[model samples]
Target chain A: MEHYNMNLTLKVWKQKNTNASGSFEIYQVKDISSEMSFLEMFDVLNEQLILEGKEPIAFDHDCREGICGMCSMYINGRAHGPWEKNTTCQLHMRAFKDGDTIVVEPWRSKAFPVIKDLMVNRSAFDRIIQAGGYISVNTGNAQDANALPIDKKNADDAFMAAACIGCGACVAACKNSSAMLFVSAKVSQLALLPQGQPERESRVLNMVAQMDKEAFGNCTNTYACEAECPKGISVSNIARLNREYLSASLSTEE
Target chain B: MGLTGLFLVTFLIVHAGVNACIFINDGGATFNAAAHFMSHNWVIRIMEIGLFAGLIAHILQGLLLWKQNTAARPTKYAMSAANENSKWYSRSMGILGSLLLIFLVIHISKFFVGTKVAMYADGGANDASHNLYLEMKEEFQKWWVVLIYSLGVISLFWHLLHGFQSAFQTLGINHKRYTPLIKTIGVGYTFIICLLFLLMPIAFYFGWIQ
Candidate 1:
């Protein structure tokens, strides 16, 4: 790609802490290379702020390779910039033109409260996973990898569903702020595997109850969650989740 | 919501079949025959109760989901291109459902309740039970009523456009090969049913049918 420089203005959301009322603060950055990742541009702006003895903008990021899912922000109305199936860390300045004013904000959900600036507390996701997102098994000798023959289709689907990074993008993209996509991904992943069958019924029931308890909205089948997912997780997982939930609820009944 | 929605879809097909009898153009004769069968048959009557239960359940589920969804996002985003993310009809189910609900109330009050009343109170020689075809005819004669029915059909069209495939997907009936087929069938189903419904009011009001 040809390299070029651009000057731009960013409208960044600013907050002192969780209790403080947040607002947007405008800042300018000049001579940004088009090939630079969006976070690099932010780094440039922060470096300038440090030189001026002003507090730098705080944002969450690690493993800037888009796999960590730590760089969560809504760029110009999208969950992770303008790219499809990409996290914010993968977004490059080339996506924008010179003189463009970009708006940035943290994920807006009651379940995820802003900690400071663009960083929000996503530990709610951890609690949901802790509720019942895993399979429990006896600690014994390691079983052979091929002990159970798995169908290729089922294995592929299980792999796909397991790709969810718990980035909270699905919730942010949803009009209802629903976490169904994330939860469904987890549910379908386990439900599709033979090893996960032991706790299938209780797993779905417990995880869904936990998701609802977490203050997330119900899925309305908007398809936005699938669209905005960085891992390209399909809404079919949600369908599977619903089916699992229904059957589990029935089978558990006396 | 998916189960109830699929039940209602089946009900619509049965309803459209019965209503299509009006196209015989025999001055409400065939339509009244079908209408009488639907209203008087004990089995049909029992199924009607189940249909009502399904409809009520679907409506209740929709309302509850809407409330929970709204509560999920207590704060609005500073800037959002929500339209860019999802289709308008997919996001506006609540508003569309509300419109359909109002239309349903008027429709049930006009025909279903009228039929029940007529069934109880016989009007001399004119069997009120079989007079549903006439009731529909007279109702469609009013221009405003025709407009309301047309709007209701319009809402139904959009609702089914999303709900049909969505119901199957929610039920986990989706597959790469079959999903496209279901979607096509859904589109065709929505167009045909809504068009048939729309044509009924237009045909009555335009003197195309007495």
Candidate 2:
């Protein structure tokens, strides 16, 4: 593919810490190659910032391979940039045009407090996951994956649910700010697998309760989370979460 | 609203069937007897408790969910353009549901509660069935009541359009093969029920039905 050189204007949020009042600061970058990944472009910007004796914009990134999901950003009004099924780091500069103005901001949610500019505290997600996302398998008691003999249908569903990276993009995209998609993904992943059967009841109940405690919003069926998700996770997962919650709540045993 | 709302879906189907019986033969006596039996029946009375419980649970859950959603995003959309990609019902479910709740209050007050207590309190001076039927007719005759009910029905339909499929999906009925089919069925059910419910008031208002 032929690469084109582009100049872009970026309005980025800057904050010292969680309590700090932040504002958008504009920056202009010159002659960037279209083939550069979004994070690479950020690298160029940080180089420029460091050259000017300024602190680099602190954003989250790790594998940059799209699987880790540590790279989270709201770009030009879309999560993970304009590309479908791609994370922010995987999004390349080619997605934009020559003289484009890009707006970059962090995932905005009360549950996800901002740690710094473009880096919000996503520990809320960790808490939700910890509250129930795993089965209680001991190290030696581990069974072979094939031992369960899950139906192909259920296996596929479990894979799909496991696809969720706990990115909190669902909360960012939802109008109600609901994390149903995230919670549901966790619930469905386990509910579909026999391994998850043991903690199934407590898992959904605790996660939902923790989700509420974190002050996440209830789902109002806005499918934005599914649409914006880099993984293309389904809203159906949220539906599953609700079902699990209901079942757990109505069950005779605690 | 998860379980209770789903339960109400069941109640809606049964309730609609019962109400539709009024138009089955267009016999005032038959309709009246049916209504009297429904109001006085012990089984239905127990179901009424379940219905109230469902309504309360649905509303409380909805409210809690709404509060959390609001808290999740302290900032409102800086611009309205982001809403272009969203479904109208999905965005407005809370508002629409609250409006429907208001309609439900009026509906129960007028028909269920009114027919049960007020209609009988008058010592049958007005025939119970005739009074109940006329009460509905008079309400439908007003253009505003018709308008309100029509809006309520549309909102109800939209709510169910998302809700029915969602409930099934949550219950783990979503096989890729069956999920789409189920969603289609959900849409169809919502459309038919809303259309049928709206027709009653509109037909009565226009004097198509006595």
Candidate 3:
């Protein structure tokens, strides 16, 4: 792959904390390598800000690979920038042209309050997981991997559902800031397998109740979550979640 | 919400089909008969109450959800590229539904009031004098009324385009194999239903149908 160096302007959001007012701060990074990941480019700009005796922009990142879902920059209006089905850390500087102005912000949702510039608190997701986090297992001995004999389709679909990284991009991408995609993915991964059968009903019902309690919007089925999701999680899981919720609500004694 | 939305969707089909009897070119004879039967039938009358229930439930549910959805994002994004991922119609359902609501008020006032009133006045007389087809012709002749009807149908078109497939997804009936078919059917249904409804007004206003 051909690599080139380019200079660009960055319009990054700057906020002190969740309660403080926020605004955009512009910076210029010179001679950025096209090979550099988007977060690396941010690191260079932060270095410049530090040398200039200004506060370095605060943001979040963990594994620079796409798995951690920590890099939650809403670049130039898109969830993880212009690349389809990509996380911000996997986004490279080559996606931009020299002298382009890049706008970066954090995931904006009432549940995902801005902890700092380009870093929103995502513990809302953890609470949602905790609400529906139980599965009953026969705990006598370690069973063989192939003992379950799961249908191939169910296995594949459950694996796909398990790929969600809890990035909150789906929430960022949704107009209503709905967490349905993330919640649905978690519900589906368990619901599709026979082992997950015991708590399938309660899992969906409690998770949905918790999600609503968190003040997240309901899904309108715009399918924007599927489009902006970095791991290519499907919207079909949402249908399954809805089905599970309906049955659970009707059947549950509680 | 999905259940009520689908109920309204089904109502559109029967309304459009019964009105399309005007296409028979029989000088309102066939059209009036169908209209009379629809107005006079007891089963349809009971279902009409259910239809009102569905419509009211749909509106109340939609308003509640819209309020919650709005509250969910108390702070507006400084910048968001929503169009990059979803269709504009899918996001603007509230506005479109509101527009349709206004149009529905006008429609019920113009046509439904007259039909039901006449039915009540006659009291099982089977009065063919009502001439609902003639009423359509007269009502649509007003350019402003026809314009309102046109706008209403346009809103219905966009609403159905998203709501049709959306209802299936919400009902948890979506499948990789059937979802595509559902979308295609949704498009076809939207076009045919909206076109028929739109053309009815234009045909009367322009003297294409008597």
Candidate 4:
């Protein structure tokens, strides 16, 4: 594809820390290549700020290819960008044109507090995972791929659910700030497999309890999370999550 | 909320069906008899208690859920393109539900109270004395009353449009084959129920039906 260069304006949110209030700060960047990823554009802007003896803007990123789930940016009112099933780092600047003005902000959720300019502490997700997003079985060695027979449909669905990168996009996109999509994807990833069967009940129950404890909003099934997810995570996983949660709650001896 | 909401959904069918009796155009005879039977039957009376309980539960649960959902976002976004992702009615259930609650209060006061008062005055026996059909005609003759009723039905239409499928999804009843089906049925249900309800007010107001 042919690449072109463009100049653009950016309006970015700046916060000193978790306790500090944030505001939009505008800046102009020149000769930005359309081939550059959205984060690279930010890098150019940050370099400009440094040259001007100004503080560089801070944002999150790790595996720039999009698998790490570390990058989280609400660009132009979208969790990642305007692109469907795209992450912030993977969002090409080609989506915009010359003289475009892009606005960026960190994910806003009560459960994910702002740590600095464009990074929010996502340890709440870590805490939720700790709550029971794992299996108890201690398999000392790798098993043969064919050792456990799995249904083709369940395997496909499980693979799809496992594609979720645990990005905060679901929470960011939700009107209620709900993490149900992320939680449900995680739940469905395991719930469909025999390996996940043993801990399935406890996993859903504990994780949901921890999720509720995290001050995340409840799911109203508005389904914005599915629409905005970079992985294109399906909302049907949320149905499975609800099913697992309800079944577990019902049969629990406690 | 889903369970209670579906209960109310069923009640809407019964409500719209009974009210549609007015279309019989038999000088209120068929309509008042059905209304009288609904009010005076003992089994129906007990079911009415359950209906009220379910409605109150749905309302209270909805309010509490709305409160928690609101508190989830302590800081609002400076810019939101939420409409890019979801429909407005799905996200605005709280406001729609509040509007519906206001309409419901007006409805109960206008027809329910009058019908009950007329019954109690007539020794709580099965009586055609209340002339509820005439009352509806006269009450709807007021342009404001018809306007409010129209607005209520419209609000109810939107609520059901999202809610019918939503209740099933909440109950963990979603399926690839069935979710689409439920959505189609939900739209059809909304239109039919709301039209059935809207027909009465517009018909009475315009004197299209006796």
For all candidates, state DockQ relative to the true structure: 0.71, 0.39, 0.83, 0.84
Evaluate all candidate structures by whole-model CA lDDT and list the values in order. 0.90, 0.80, 0.91, 0.92
Docking class of 3: high
Candidates 1 and 2 compared by lDDT, better number = 1
lDDT of 4 by residue, B1-210 (tens): 889999999999999999999998988888888998999899999999999999999999998999999999999888899989899999988889999999999999999988888878758663556788889999999999999999999899889988999999898988999999999999999999999999999999999997
Q: In candidate 4, how many Å is residue A150 off?
A: 1.0
Query: How do all the candidates rank in terms of lDDT, highest first?
Result: 4, 3, 1, 2
**Clashes in predicted model 4:** 0
Question: Could you say which candidate leads in DockQ?
Answer: 4
lDDT-better candidate, 2 vs 4: 4
lDDT of 3 by residue, B1-210 (tens): 899999999998999999999988788999888887888799999999999999999999999989999998887877788899999999999999999999999999988998877767768353656888888888888999999999999999999999999999999988879999999999999999999999999998888876
> lDDT (0-100) at residue B87 of candidate 4?
96
lDDT of each residue in A148-236, candidate 2, tens digit only: 68899788888988998877777877777778888888889999987899888999999999998998876666678888887888777
Residue-wise lDDT of candidate 3 within A1-254, one digit each (tens)?
Answer: 78999999888999998999999888889999999999999999889888899999998999988999999999999999999989999999889988999999889899999998989999999999999855766688878999989999999999999999999999998988999999999999998888789888889988998999899998999999999999999998889888889889999997
Per-residue lDDT of model 1, residues B36-132, tens digit only? 8898899999999999999999999999998888888887888888777788898888899999999999999998887777677654334553478
Candidate 1 vs. true structure, TM-score:
0.93
Candidate 2 wrong stretches, greater than 4 Å: A48-55, A128-159, A183-212, A219-223, A234-254, B21-33, B40-42, B76-86, B127-129
Ranked by DockQ from best down, the candidates are: 4, 3, 1, 2
Best by TM-score: 4
Report how far off residue A228 is in candidate 4 (Å). 0.5
* Model 1 per-residue lDDT tens digits across residues A39-62: 999999999999999999999999
Candidate 1 chain A has its poorest 10 consecutive residues by lDDT at A137-146
In angstroms, the error of model 4 at B114 is: 0.5
